[model samples]
Target: MTGFHFTVLIQLLYRVGKAPTVILQPNRTVVYRGERVTLRCEIWGGGGTEWTYEWKTNNGNAEKSSNEYIINRVSDTNSGKYSCMARGDHQLTEWSDAVTLTVRLSKPTVILEPSGPVVYRGEKVTLRCEIWGGGGTEWTYEWKTNNGNAEKSSNEYRINRVSDTNSGEYSCMARGDHQLTEWSDAVTLTVRLSKPTVILEPSGPVVYSGEKVTLRCEIWEGGRRTQWTYEWKRNNGNAEKRSREYRIITVNEYHSGKYSCMARGDHQLTEWSDAVTLTVRLPITPTVIKQPSWAQIYRGERVTLRCEIQDDGGTQWTYEWRPNNINSPTSSEFMITADSRGYYSCRGRRDSFTITKWGVITLTVFNSHPAASLSVSPDRVQHLIDQSVTMNCGGNDTKWRMRRFTGSTSPSYVQCSNWGTMHGSSCTINRLEDHSGVYWCESGSGEFSNAVNITVQDDYYDVIILVSPVHPVTEGDPVTLSCRDKEQNLLSNVIFYHNNKLINNDSRGELKISAVSKSDEGFYKCQHSGKESPRSWMSVRGEKD
Candidate 1:
């Protein structure tokens, strides 16, 4: 390897380096008027070489012994593309890439937070001074209004409580490091007084309990209608509400007090309204009492209903009735007659504005006599000939006799000895064909009880009878009837008739009447395969209370 003893020398050289890059002090290409800007030429891998920079701009080129070029106060004439080159070690580096600079000379703008400068007195108002292209600059704001000029160190001018004196044409300007910007366009502010008035709906000092009332807060002058929030106070206590009006669906004695209202907007509360006094009077409720107190009355019977108001100290009052009969007396008592089988209500009025709650009652009346009831020992639709049966008469009255009708010109009333054995209220009889008739109990005063039909049938005729209700049925009640043979077995494939006319042919052999009314009362009968039953009478009572 030492043969020849000769060495070779190689020279390595690193060119000056890649092109340098131009950088801004704040790293932003945009600058504002009177703003300080510094441009730097950065070289990488220079090996700690000291370099001098040449800055090129649209205006001209300048050479500096340092790498940084600074503009103390930039103006519109300083806006352009700028680049720099570095010279070190007797070699020149490539020109750095260009950076664009924008300088704005226009005046700043005045911006309000709520946009609209119209506000109410005692409200918070904020005014902001905005510089469109003046980023990265610390500015001092000057607020100029009709009042005077104010030098606020911050960009925002705030008034914690703006008064009427603060309303006027407002303009703003900004001062940065170098010079002061021109005044912006004027923005008008209007401050108004917001004093509310409490208005009662009825406009009356006294209102009856259980009446509807409303209290409205009417603002004298304020901002936009949508900007206001309402608060109601009763006797210095807070009432929760948001709308302008506070309503009470049912005002009672507890609601009676001094009420006032205030409005809030723009972080300010208006003055409380004048208090309005309200007095809620308890209304008198009258009760209706019926004289000769009874649940029911005869058609021609007389009765009296009196409207009595409790705690009334001999106050002269008039009465009002639901029927409002033209010929009715204005007194508290109302005389009921034959046509008085319905609901009755009454109310008392001491004056046009004072009235009591209505009191209501019901009266039931019947057309026929409802004295007693007659029943049989073994209840059945029809009884076999020569079968023993007992009949009983019972009611509030005891003096009664069994009466029967058998197509006779004159009806006969008798005791058990003539037809059956009598004991207390019951009579036992051995049924005969002649005993088949409509039987009932008759009082000594000629009042009769509900009647029943005692049918006696012989087995020889293969007879059938209509099974119907024995007692009178009230209106709006369901009634059903069926057909049966002599053996007491229900029959099918039967056709029913009302008042001797065909009503319907039921598959279930039943005549069903739903919500039976007075029009349904009449004689009802049924017919099976070939035999027809005897027609039975059905009664329907009128509606009652």
Candidate 2:
């Protein structure tokens, strides 16, 4: 049996063509839940033959043998890849390329018609309910609110006028034939009070002339997203100002008025704010300040004038002085050296701009004879250290005494017995020192002479240069160099040097360097009449970039 068991074998073969293709009836793979869909399988380019179709799904569901598949209600659980094949009598063709099907749940949403979530009171608003993936099915709508129990059946909810009680969260839901959609995401709705208030900038409504004033309109309860246009009325005037604030610069009496403001936003107008009144008055009058004395005074008597604002108290103030109806170069106070006589007036100022009314005062001058004149023996105002100097009071008076006014001390006449010898209306100092100052003559009748200033220089009276700002001068700053003796007496026809090299010769004994730089910094000195001064170091600091 094993040897002779060679049986005849016949091989069955089938000609194969292009693979089949699957087509969806609706041409769309995605469908909403509870929607009906049909998928049809087709075979192309195969020989004419009777065949049976088989279907497979990537979701591991059982296979079927139909050319078309119908789903009464598609759901998320039935979504997957689908394929089909055709089996003939002699052979089976390859499966078609996969087609994906996706199912999504329907969800409803609520949207505001005007887009802004915040609405002013007395404004009309609308809320719309919408459902996606419902497949043109008729749906019933319902709304829920967090603030109060509100029910509505239509797809849209209309609010004729919003109020504070309507401010809360809002949500919607839709119901179809087969299912009820989940509640949509909540949307917030705000209803705000649109009452506005008016305020004064300086708090106090009363202000002086030349002061600035501002009126501001404010809405306290409205949301920041609300845009507003302001309307302001002043003192019930017919004209209305369209601005948030009204400013008055250099305020005067005409600018004082009662102001009221109102706002309009979100298609609604707010109530007028409380009215506020402002008043502007003239500045306080200025007063003259000085020692009380007779309005009329004789010549050679010192005169001083000072001005003050009545309300200034101790506050600092600047003064503008007018002498004889002409502007004078004086501030806060004025000094008249016995030679001046005129009518003086002054105005007190705050911040150099706000000025008060001017205060006036008068002065008179009278000339007298037998006046004394002071003179120094050396003829020069400055004397060398330890050098004897003689002072004589030249006048017609027979009896006279010398008087001195030092540093900041008050003047008083006294005898020369303390520090010098008195000889025939003259005083002689054996050795001059720093104590020497302004000197004059006083007769027995208390008549005073013209004053003369004497400055005693130190032993090191050589030429020296003085710098306005000592060392470490900043770049771009002005610098001044002065040539003088040890007693600060300026010298003329002096030559200045930088780093031992001659720079320039100045007849005024002063050198000015505007906007100093690094090159201007070095050892500096001055030479006058073949005399050289001690060298001084100067440094310029550069600014940081």
Candidate 3:
């Protein structure tokens, strides 16, 4: 081969083994503020071989000679076009394609004071717009809420006495001269309402024993009814109930106290309501006192009936007295000249409406007969076992003896000895027995006093008749009759008798009268399987005349 042929072969071999092309590392052109950005020089076709690199900007400025061009902190000053070249052992490659580096302006942000995004009613809050880079006082702030433009212009927005209508998403932007920045990150603001009020049912705070009471708590907020949880506190203690309404089956004196409530929903708790008070009172029972505690008083003598209260405090009392077939008198103590015979009852009053139970007494005024007359205390014809009975022979005479008669035997009078004790003109019988009979007084001169019939019964074995609302029931009122056995257990399938005549045969052994009249007043008894209960008298008083 000649020299020309050899040179052509060498040129063809050098063209096949040429240097690789240089290129930029990253394809992106945008960079943010305060970010670390790196531009690298890369060779595309040089099969795993290393090369030296050099970088330059479009402004003709020389950068570093390393394989990578780095900007520790990029800003607006770093914006330009960049290119790189790679150097191999044989020759240097051409410049890479130019890459535009864009450094954008920083975005502004919105911040809320007092930490939380929620504020209660009647409270103040502040929202501040912040931009990192310094742009002097010429920067104007604009705000938007819930995607709608707001009419404020200050950097700091102050809200006074915020309400529920002020809740929305808020954002801000900065404008200086002819340049306006993009909107900042959005923040949410929530305005809440205060707590609700609690109310009592029946519209009154006073409660009596054996009565039911109810308390209700109401909340008006934006949520489903089932989402709310109610908490109730009695006298400032821990929660006792977790329902909207609190109920009391029965109220007593110990149940008197204050009450409050609150509501919790949506991971938030509302303030407590204003406290309310409850007052519970006990049943009132008054005492009746009869002056000159004697079995009988002569005509033209002075007698007094007094009404009193027991174990009571912090109360002022008035009184009322009712005598049979006569107008009632209002006084604590009533005085009368013993010229009439009647049944009398008295009651005490705390206020014009609040009254105690009535207590009954019987008074008998006797005329002066030439012979002595015998009378009994309590004036009741029937007496219970284990009860005391007293008999008095009217007169100051000392030589008086007591006698008891059984059946209709002639002259069959037995002198009192083992049956009772005698104390000058009076005889006392304790622990009455079934054999006790009619009694009369006998003077030393063989003259006899008036006779009185006395009947004795066993209190434990006798049936009890229960009257709803107790005895002395007012006329034109509903009444219920219940028969109980000696053990206080209710008797079923019993027959009720009024005035010794069968009136009703009920399975539940109860008799009810829808409205009572004067004719309903009578003696009542109950009978079960050939056993009869002692008669109990029911008294119904008419309305005031």
Write candidate 1's Cα lDDT for 1-545 as tens digits: 67577688865434576998888976788767778899888888876787777888874665564678789888888899888887776667887788989877558887886677678765778888788657777788888878586656577878877777788888888888796788899888888676788888666677679777888999855235447888888898866666898888888999999999888877767788889998897876789887445454555343568899874366677998877764355789875543447888899876655578998988877766668768886565466675688888989777778766554423444445777777777778866656776677777887766556666666556888778876556789898788877677888888888867888554667778889886776667788778887776666666761
> In model 1, what is the error at residue 180, expressed in angstroms?
99
Summing lDDT over every window of 10 consecutive residues in candidate 3, give the lowest-scoring window.
11-20
Candidate 2 lDDT, tens digit per residue, 411-511? 45345776689999999988766554656677888776655555555555453434333324567888877766655578778788886788865455688
Please report, as a residue range, the 10-residue window in candidate 1 with the lowest summed lDDT: 407-416
Q: Which candidate leads in lDDT?
A: 1
Residue 469 error, candidate 3, Å:
77
Best by TM-score: 2
lDDT of 2: 0.70
Which candidate model has the greater lDDT, 1 or 3? 1
Q: lDDT, candidate 3, residue 395? A: 61
**Better candidate by lDDT, 2 or 3:** 2
Give stretches of model 3 more than 4 Å off: 1-28, 44-50, 59-62, 115-123, 135-137, 194-545
> Candidate 1: lDDT over CA atoms?
0.74
User: Predictions ranked by TM-score, top down?
Assistant: 2, 3, 1
